[model samples]
Target: MPRCIPIKEIKNTTEFARIVEESPEPVIVTRNGREAFAAMSIELLDAMRMERARAELYRLLDEAEEASRDGRVVDARDSIKRTRDRYGL
Candidate 1:
């Protein structure tokens, strides 16, 4: 579970800062009785970003299945050369 109490329950800034620092889970900060945003440890944020990148790569592969089945895929070696040349790699 997330480690935050309601924004109303924050008696002071120190308690808010403490929970944000100590909790492994994210804390939802509210403003004007609505969710403002979440705060999480940097490690958790990086893990989430990596997971999103993997998901995007998988989506591209799935979309290309028909091209692969029809032998429309580019050669790996040619693709690598094209990419390297495009980027001056």
Candidate 2:
């Protein structure tokens, strides 16, 4: 289980850093007797971000496949040119 700490505990920077460094699980910061946010290592954060990005890419690919099946797809070169023209690139 993750460690829970009050918002006030964040005031002690040294202690907070120690807890984060020593704990493998994420630290949950609570406020007003409610769960607020989680503090996690950069490695964990980066992995989560990469997972989300892969999921998003898969979703876009699925949508593009559906569009292609529906004969609503555009040529890649024309699409790029149109995008460049639209954005004044």
The local distance difference test score of each candidate is 0.82, 0.90
Provide the lDDT at 35 for model 1: 79
| lDDT for 10 (candidate 2) | 97
Candidate 1, backbone clash total: 0
Instruction: Give per-residue CA lDDT, model 2, range 1-89, as digits (tens).
Output: 99999999899989898887777878999999899998988776777899999999999999989999999988999999999999999
TM-scores of the models, in the order given: 0.60, 0.66
Deviation from truth (RMSD, Å), model 1: 4.0
lDDT of 2 at 55: 100
Instruction: Rate residue 14 of model 1 by lDDT.
Output: 86
RMSD of each: 4.0, 3.4
Best by lDDT: 2
Candidate 2 regions off by >4 Å? 22-25, 77-89
Clashing pairs counted in every model: 0, 0
